[model samples]
Target: MKPAKNSPRARIVRYTVFGAISLAVAVITAFGYLRYEQRVDAMHPALTGIALQMRHDPAAWTRQERDASEMLRDIREEKVAAIGVSRDAILVSTQTGAKYFVTDHNGAFSNALLLGEMKAGADAPYQLVWLPDANLQTGMARWAAAFDKIRDLITLLMPLMLIGGLFWFMRREMTGGAQLLEESPTLRFEDVIGAGEAKAALADVQSYLTDPARFTDMGVRAPCGILMTGGPGVGKTRLAQALAGECGASFISITGSYFSAKYYGVGIQKVKHLFELARKNSPTVIFIDEADGLGKRTDTGGGPAEAESNRIVNQLLAEMDGFASNQGVIVVAATNHPENLDEALRRPGRFDRTVQVRLPDLEDRAEILRFYAAKLTSKADDIDFGQLARLTTGLSPATLAMIVNQAGLVARKAGASTITAAHFIEAIKIARIGDVSGAERALSEEERTRIAVHEAGHGLVAALLGTGVLEEITILPRGGALGVALVTKAQDKHLYRETEMRNEIQVLLGGRNAELLVFSEASSGAAQDLQEASRIGLDMVSKFGFNVDGNLFSLAALPAQYAGLQLKNAIEHANVLLRELDDACQALLRANEPVLRAIAERLLESETVSGETVEQLIREHAAASSPSMHLAQEPAAA
Candidate 1:
């Protein structure tokens, strides 16, 4: 509804316009007063002497003296033209022939009470003239110039068209429509390939938003907060933004990190103010990115920072748990480290529903790559997802996009008209390690052979393992690595089997073993591989109960109570497992020693291989049961 015409806000717009006009008139009038009174030229005795003499002998005065009086009168009118009525001042006539009432007046400038009293008792014995409503005439003439200027300005502004737009804009802001959220593109369900459970959860929420009344009588309470928790680049933010678009609610986004301030309570105050603003416009969704900043655990013995942050979290908790349901106010917070959030804040009253956003599956990756490549030119008919997906194993959606963009850049730089499979292939190789252009790290020939063979060994092992896990092998170093071998899960299966975990560890070790056998020593190049493999093995023993040596029959995921705890527990767990972890890694390596050596031998031939190569190897030596199968089948062929 349009705002009522008499409302304070509407009046404010009108008053503001009037006040501005009043100020302008006051300035012009002051200028006129200064011009008339400040100069003191008209008030000079020499200038007035002609008028004094003319008054002494009314009929005997010369034409020059009369002209002087006329000039003085004209000057007085000019001074009055500039004077605003707000301040007290004297008034006079412009010409001798016209009466004071017939004289010109300034427009709209208020006439003053003191003006008449001063003119009536002027003490001019010789010229006894009492003017009627002369003050009103003077004010009208003085302010007329101001009105004329405003009218001219209004005419000029009409052409600019900003007046109407600004009026509507201010009215819209005053009324509440300006606070309405704008439309954003919502991703189709097809865009999100993994997290079926999370999708179902989101779907339910969508349904709730569509028909809140339907759930109202069902005794269901809308979730106050939907906590999207996952590793980085897993698309938590994209999904929430999609939800915002889907619901058509006001979307206000702020990062927890942006709340920092020198004052202890300033962040808390800002948080309250923001929430209040959001609530004032109900049916709003506030998305806080990286909420760990405000939600970090408070029990840690940090300084005053923890105490202040706790206050901020406390305010947020209150806001979430307030009387309003999700129908009125909904909050979606995304954080990579959900484990770092405070415990109290994660309870049901706060973030009632926690959605786990896991990595995308192969199909999802293919879709994501296709989505990103939509704008790029196809390099050749060889640009196949079958090969691309296999090559880009374990890459996040974001990483996949970067690879595609970089591939396009490579195609452009090479002066290729169309992006081809070779560009994608090169992009994948580069993504695995990173670009090594000019001043790129120069490895020794021996180191290069070792890295290439190590990656090849891993690829071969993954492909030869019963189900064939190896996706690709690259000598390109990416993300703090010399080279990497990628292994993909057959499907994006969340739960891992002991055998799969064991195979993954073995695959991780394949590179180190390949380097050791080929180069006779492992360099820091194996640092990342060893770190990953060790962590997996350690988790198997500590949390997953895969090791059977310690805490069997236990699910290692965070307990409901301790879900959003801090990093301290994770660190302590790593430390405790440290005492018993080394032996497990050593045992797994020892059992796979022969197999690793055999795989390394095969890798030494090619230095790198693809899933297709591994498949071909197994197909060529079908009778062979592992790398041993190749050897056993090999003797028959020989």
Candidate 2:
């Protein structure tokens, strides 16, 4: 029976036959061309100068005949049989049918003349002709024939090989291109840290996946899809996996870029295949990480890439919305840039719910640190999770985990049996800034002194103003900075008062002010300090309504239509506030020159001074300067 044309078996048979025919035709044509070349070469030998030389002068003919006779003597004892010189050429033929032709320059001999000469060669008007050995000539001809056959065979097989390779690759892509993870996730909520609210939000989806029949009977459909939006390393993907684990469902994971293919329609096919897999494995969580790869579509026409992206997104939407039954399949997608996702994918019925996974806060960071620390062989009491959490404000859970692991590494490198607080501190420094220990040894004495002065100035001003708890002051270069003054709040503060903002600006400018007071001129080392101080000043004027003019209205809060003159006034006011703050910082540095000098001197000796030591220096200076004044007790570690 004849098979259908589009069937896989039929297609394979057709391709095989076509490839075989093409290969056969190629071999035949190549062999025929080679044979024709060989025949042409035999008819007209490449070397023709010997015949021309013989015909050029009759006086030299006897000498040439003697030379040709000697040449024949070297060829395995083959004798000179005959010489046939035509009008245009002289021909020498070997017994093995190899012919050599040499041209005659003069018109002294014709073909008929040569034939007559050959017939009368035994007695009249004959010349000696060189003939090659029959055995050697036969062996060379056989090698040439073998080489030609090999070349023809390669030419024959090339097309077939290419076709077969293409067929195999296409079949593989059709059958197993889209990877699906059939195993259920092993990551439970207990295994995950941070994203507490996101976990709470996904609890409903977990319930639905766990018991789809209960929801189906009550006419309440499970959420078709969940979209997770967050910054990178905030645990959106972890949350999705945890949801899968919570319900003991099969997990199929793929990135948004998985639907992208070089060929058209392939992405759409992948989307269809992905959905089919999810359906086959009911109670499955299909996690698509980096969903922004689908891209936001436009109404205006674009290139082929844009069109393909649109088609894939459309197919995904269709699959999500066209499911015949709930089937306990939940489509979960995570994107760092949710705004870059297609609007169609974010529609109500399609995504059904959106969860935001934000950076871990202080308590959450502490929790994450504790979780990772428990996995390490460490002195548990030596590691201060609260202080580490306070220092790592705005850090993600991933970063917190890294801090723990890096601490373990640092401890091991130092030949310590267990991790310690000092190791965690070093790890935090590495994570926050980078390894600065090597860079510290490279600094010259002058640069070290300058850096020490700059960092001491920052630490002193922050402590004096009570802006926050002074953590550490170091002249060790970190990242782009030549020095650093680490500060942390006793607790996370979501709102700041105007005085607190101003005090923060003053601390930022203290480094530059200290430079001016000590060196009689400020260096360019305070460029970052100045920039940060300016930003805070501008925010106070335009955003926070803390302008010196007491204008309750925020310039940034105004619409663009009304911001022409108001924007300029806000900027002018910000500059005035910066000048005022700068003067205050200079005066403060001048007044506390003795304490600043003490801190900078200590730093120059140690390269790094603890915040408590800096605070102690300030307290001692205050007490000595004013005997009757009362000093506040030292603040506890954050």
Candidate 3:
């Protein structure tokens, strides 16, 4: 059997062919250059000193008669073929096809005559009148010119040849590199954790891939393309592979970036080849990951880049439309940004169905956690999936997996036999904020006191206002924060009430308010707290339309003519609302100053305080202060 195009043997053969061609070109170029050099040397023979003296000063030859005899002897020894003299010139010819000429003045050659000036009976300038082989010299000069031209031509073509070869190799790879899985993916529907709705949406696709003839008989067309849209790591690609595995069809996966190349038309070729391969396999599933890389093309009348993009997109559309619905070739593509794709690709008869793989919900998160936890050699029964799911609200499936894996790693690092709740908790902290245990900075007593107070203030206020369940509050530094107070809700919330938003803003301001009340001034640590509080206040006023005036006009809906004035009003209203909230927050903290101080002192002692401990502290302080006065309870479900 022929070797695969990308196999080592094939690669070696391909490279060898290219290498041989390059070597041959190099050899020819070198040979031509050497030959040209030889001809050049032959064309210009070296002259002797006497020959040079005769040419420059012929009269010196007559003054030095002995020197003339020596010149004759030297000429005879040097194989000078002939010598000619005229009234104003003398010429010497050599047997090896070289000729030298000298001008003679003062009638230096009275008896001698030039070849052109010689009569039939005139005495000859020399004993012998020989002609150099003009034909041989002319031929050799022509040959040298030819060799020089050949060398220059080869030198010029070398780079072009190499570039052309490279383009060919790249084009071949780009168009043919996408390999179908030697064996179909084994990831079935059961293998995918979340994305129930997405799976349900793809049920028909699964059925058709299993039995295309069943649909064909009923004259029903199977979905030719599926576009899975979701945030990254939401299991879209896995779901696609599952669809293929469910039917045991061939799976071919290629990223959208695979089609992009610097060479013109290479992308188009890749697109065509990809679809063609899928069709040939019949009952094949083509999964293109990160399809947004080949997204909507913008026409700025730009040059080749824009044109190439347009062509690639156009080719993709054509391929999708060109295939028949019953061809049993389904093209599944996943993209984080589905809106960026070309409209043509999303139209009917192409990627007609767009499946949204949303983030896993509470129940789904619980299921996913159980699925991953079951695979680990841990106390899976002891692990509370519900609590873990609640703690990981809004996290993707990938992050959930990472948390479980990290938990196992944490357990292993502790030299524990099985994972435990405490290990998982530590893992959660590491995953959420990052492992900053080693990053803790040495703080002075005063700064440590301030950090403890700041974090304690946040926890106390959150508990007092029932914003959320305080998970943990710590004076220990993590990430960029000198202190952190983590609060989690009882469950995920999709909507919020005006009072709840105000309560959240208060919780954000709690730290800063505590610093101000305790130290008579706030520190720079409140910068993030102030920014977050300001953002919530502004959103409430401008976006949520939660102003006191009861106006429902959103900032985004404001008329352009009134936008500036309305926005100014919104900012003023936000500022007024924040001041009011700040005053209320400070008052609450002042009344419960004992409780804040107690929490801060506990944090200073242990560097960390659990939510239950803070709540106990609050209850103790409230009861000690006044038996009749009740502390705020957790807010009721909306």
Best by TM-score: 2
Write candidate 3's Cα lDDT for 526-600 as tens digits: 898889888899889888988877867788786888787777888888999999999999999999999999899
State in Å the error of residue 117, model 1: 58
Q: Distance (Å) between predicted and true CA of 265, model 1?
A: 3.8
lDDT of each: 0.62, 0.78, 0.80
| Tens-place lDDT digits, model 1, residues 115-226 | 2344654553222222223333234555776788899998998867887797765444333222334553365455565667677778766666556777778988877788
Sort by TM-score, top down from the best: 2, 3, 1
TM-score of 2: 0.74
User: In model 2, where do residues sit more than 4 Å from their true spots?
Assistant: 1-153, 167-176, 437-444, 554-566, 628-638
TM-score of 1: 0.57
Off by over 4 Å in 1: 1-180, 183-195, 217-219, 296-307, 324-327, 379-381, 437-463, 466-489, 505-638
lDDT, candidate 2, 303-343, per-residue tens: 88888888878888888887555477898999988888888
Alpha-carbon TM-score of each model against the true structure? 0.57, 0.74, 0.71
